[model samples]
Target: MKKNNTFFYLCTLLITVFLFITFTTIFSYFMLREGNKASAIKEFEVKEQEITLKTRDKLKIRVYRTKTKTIEEMDIEEYIKGVVAAEMPAEFNIEALKAQAVAARTYALAHMESVGGNGCGQINEGDICDTVHCQAYISKEDRFKAWPESKGNEYWSKIEEAVLKTKEEVIVYNNSIAKDIYYFAVSGGKTESSEEVFSQSVPYLQSVESTGEEVAPKFTSSLRYTNANFVKMINSYYPNSITSSSNLKNNIKIKNRTSAGGVKELQIGKTTITGTKFRSIMGLNSTNFSFVFNGNTVEIICKGYGHGVGMSQWGANSLGKNGKDYKYIISHYYKGVQIGKYTEL
Candidate 1:
């Protein structure tokens, strides 16, 4: 009987040990599975957050196609790619291309009708137009066609990389994106102040020296017209003011100049007009110009390629080539500004 009891006790002890081991193994397996599930959930959340941030940064814009007279909505990043491709030379430095991309983005955002701003004035149905009146935009196909076949792909890849690297970046002033971030082809050695160019004062659009524009092609242009043709053109616009070429020669004068050396007030026969107006009427390349009337022809010499306001494209390229980054280039031209991500606003 004692031997039988000992056997029963040993069996009971063995069964208890086996049951404990089984329970501990099952518990550990379940804990590991739960831990893995939690880890996966956390990773998924992180990915979702990343996706949300990307979506927020994706800006949409309405573009008006001048050729088709149609309005199409597109991603602002893509629009900026087109604008940078069309506006800046593909051969420009990557930093210069990036600067152009930011300026173009800021300009577009500032003029967005959905943000309580006026459209680009080229169309009623779109926020901006694909012309110089707003921003020059070129389709991918047209851009490729504009370049040499040998260099087209390579150049386009550079522009695309620039645009993507600086994606969602814009210039900001006073806690807001600059609305009138005007830019031009050249500056005639100096940029003009806002008040000097547009008759409206903007603190950020201050006058600044722009070097290296002299190296640009077409930096200087001369328009020469016969005295008779000059008089006819002036009279056609002014109407019955200049009776003869002599009257025009004597009456035409530069009344004053802006601080940046741009023509300010131009005196004509019995009418004084701003240099801005004169540029528009005469189709001059820029307001930074001089005029000389000789015996037979009137020669108008322009120093720059566009209105001497805000950033200069050639100047930016020069700066970039001289080891300046895009941020420095932007801040140099636009006084008292900061570079920030658009989504931050």
Candidate 2:
């Protein structure tokens, strides 16, 4: 009995010691994992803070003045003010102007050589041009010359305010400055995707609903051409496409429409062309168009203006009037984009 009791005590001691050792090992492993997780989180926070802190800098740009045929250096913020003034109407909602300001800044930085971008191809030694080829820019003298005396100063001050309020803000996608920043006057009722218009599949430049653009001056327009004249025009661009003007209605057919309801392809006699090419050949405002054959006269009615890609200025104004902020306006037009300080390239 004594021997059995001693053996039992020894067995209990060994079991307890083994259990303690196992528990200690498990606890140590969990503690080490938690510590590693905490370290990783702290490191991420530090990197984010560094990105924020490094955003402050005074940047400059070289602009190619088409009128003077010269390359002039200017402060980037001042250039943005000029761009906002030239690109958007001063009478528009303030929030809309702010959105335009951000877009202009992003566009400028995208072509600026100082920011690791390829300079404009239109110029040999400049960041960008002061024309619609790159972006329209009006100097103080030219702005005053263009605007009425009473409105020039007030309008310029408003544009300056818009630029100052959204200083250095840029549209970023996938952690980089977006290069395809295109804007237009109107979108009819919807904006077009980049793939449909420019043949480039961009993630953020996808089609979306853009309402309240009917108030824009260029929302709807019409061009009239006689049947004979229309045939001449089509033949001028695409030689001998239209042979007969008697059955003009049967000769022309809309091949297909885009996702946003813009004409994607059109069949005119023997020639089938993209809607954009047709718009160019026919002098239409946009690809969203329809024609009516009234007797011998053909009237083409067009909706929207410009390329119909990216943000719509009038649409932004409408959203701003409806109490949407600039950030909201930008996010609505540019899908899945982040607005922040100018990204370091």
Candidate 3:
């Protein structure tokens, strides 16, 4: 009887051990399979999210935010959208906005350092800045805050569409990314050549007719400065240039005019200054300006708003209103340039 009882106990112990091993194997197999399935699902979701937000040109740009004093990395397309929104008026025609989008993209690509061009030298780690020195950029939140409550979304959507439509388009010259891609607010009925404004003769940045900009707000602006103040300001920049304010008309004369009707040089007393420099010193609107002396106060009238080089924003709007497409406007302003994808070289 004792032997039979011991045999039964041993058999029961062996059966329990076998069952435990079997159960553990089955549980581990199912757990592993479920874990793998969950991982696969998570990976697919991540890829889908990437596909939703990722642009074809995944190039990143590092911008130094002047207000926040932080370097922010963003996709190039997003940067262009912000630039177009901040640079051009949201009320501008869609075609003009699209041209601005392309111009901004070309400028950014030309200055990008990751692709072998020099980045913005203002900061070490940044490719550009959120200022006019590089390109004005406004954050979506700030842009929305500045817009009317009802029109914020509508305006932003328009800018986004402009950028999306002109994706990856850049101005090129001779099968290469063009240099000195510039754009400004207004022109003096015609665009200035790169040689006249920047002192370099770029083939693509030649003089072109830019009519219909008279409707712009600052197309004809005037600023008054007392004779004494004008002489003081000019002397401050070019010391001892003008001796007195009595013979101001004779002392300050425009030496030559540019092809586009802007002042090329000005003779102020013994100092001969370029119109560009004088404009900066006197805080005038543009190089295309004239002075009127009424015995005491000198009123400087300017016919444009910016340097008068490259594309004119107001002119572009006029062209767009006249049924010109973005491509036509771009080609009109920038001569001999091809609109295409940016060349890496």
Candidate 4:
């Protein structure tokens, strides 16, 4: 009897000890796995910059200007999304980048009707150019097995939060703050005039002005004629900027004039072409310059896309590959002032 009782007690104690050990081992394994996962997230070296707001709120946002990483090397669409997300850094978060992507993509989709050379493709749409006039898009073959953004739970959550917060201003060429946007151009190096800027019209140098600057034409290109949807879309941007097809003149002669804005007045001798002809003869890249003749309105065919503003997109792609950041990229093309944020301005 004594032996039986002792044997039973030993068995129960051993079983209890085994079960305790098993539970502890499983818990330890899980804890270690979670710890490693957290560590891995921390390992990612995402840098950020801080700024003071107009309302005195301080913000810290991640900086995506990777020197060695090209758009091809990284998911460029995601990078751009982050650029516009206007997110300040927080704890273990990658969703803000996607949130910005949705908004940016929305903006792009909405304005896709604009000229090819416009928007994110412009020279200086706020702080981005996509080229020398701006920054750049990711080229082909670089988008390998990468984590691009999507409108998933994480994406939607972040976007909803970002949208509700302060909306980043839609930037335009010449640092123009817009309700939305008027025009965007895919810049090369320096933004040329309409013929150059829109029509890809090469300049014919007439003479060097007294300022030692070669002064030829405010607009050296012909009014780009296009019946394309983008041409028709220009009306929405500059409601006053576009004119009728009657702007086309038969005996049109163009001469450069310096005024509040060059190409201000288009004069065929002295009968100033004030309406659509004014825009046409002056070669100003406005909707008014479009002309209708014999059932076909002369639509100025915009060649290269964009505002022809600051940094060119292609130019930046070349430079970024050659090693440049947002700061170096902007300074190389745009003259004057150092590379610094506009802060509250």
Q: Worst ten-residue run, lDDT, model 4?
A: 205-214
Candidate 4's TM-score reads 0.30
Better of 1 and 4 by lDDT: 1
lDDT of 4 at 4: 100
RMSD, model 1, all Cα superposed?
15.5
The per-residue C-alpha lDDT of model 1 at residue 172 equals 77
Residues 1-345 of candidate 3 have per-residue lDDT tens digits of: 999999999999999999999999999999999999999986464222211112235578889999889999898899999999899999999999999998999898777777655788788777888898988999899999999999999999999999999877887776666657899999989899989888889888888899998888899999998999989998888899999998888898898999998999989999998998888887888999998989889999999898888999999999999999998999899887767764322
Models 1 onward score TM values of 0.81, 0.83, 0.81, 0.30
Model 3: CA > 4 A from native: 1-57, 342-345
| Candidate 1: stretches off by over 4 Å | 1-58
Q: At residue 324, what lDDT does model 1 achieve?
A: 100
Cα lDDT of model 4 by residue, 220-330, tens digit: 234534433323444443343335434435523344432112332344322443333344433454321333333344434222333443333344434544555433443
lDDT of candidate 1 at residue 250, scale 0 to 100: 85
> Of the pair 1 and 3, which is ahead by lDDT?
3
Q: Positional deviation of 64 in candidate 2, in angstroms?
A: 1.0
Q: Model 4's lDDT to the true fold?
A: 0.34
Worst 10-residue stretch by lDDT in candidate 2?
A: 47-56
**Model 3, residue pairs in steric clash:** none
Alpha carbon lDDT of residue 150, candidate 4?
Answer: 47
lDDT of candidate 2 over 1-345, digit per residue (tens): 999999999999999999999999999999999999999986464323211212225577899999899998899899988888888888999999999998988888888887667778888998999998888998877778888899988998888888888877888787777888889889879999999999999999999999999988899999998999999999988899999888898889998988887899999989999999999888889999998999898889999998999999999999999999998999999998777675332
Ranking by lDDT, best first?
A: 2, 3, 1, 4
Decide which is better by TM-score, 2 or 4: 2
Question: Each prediction's Cα lDDT score?
Answer: 0.85, 0.87, 0.87, 0.34
Query: Model 2 clash pairs?
Result: none
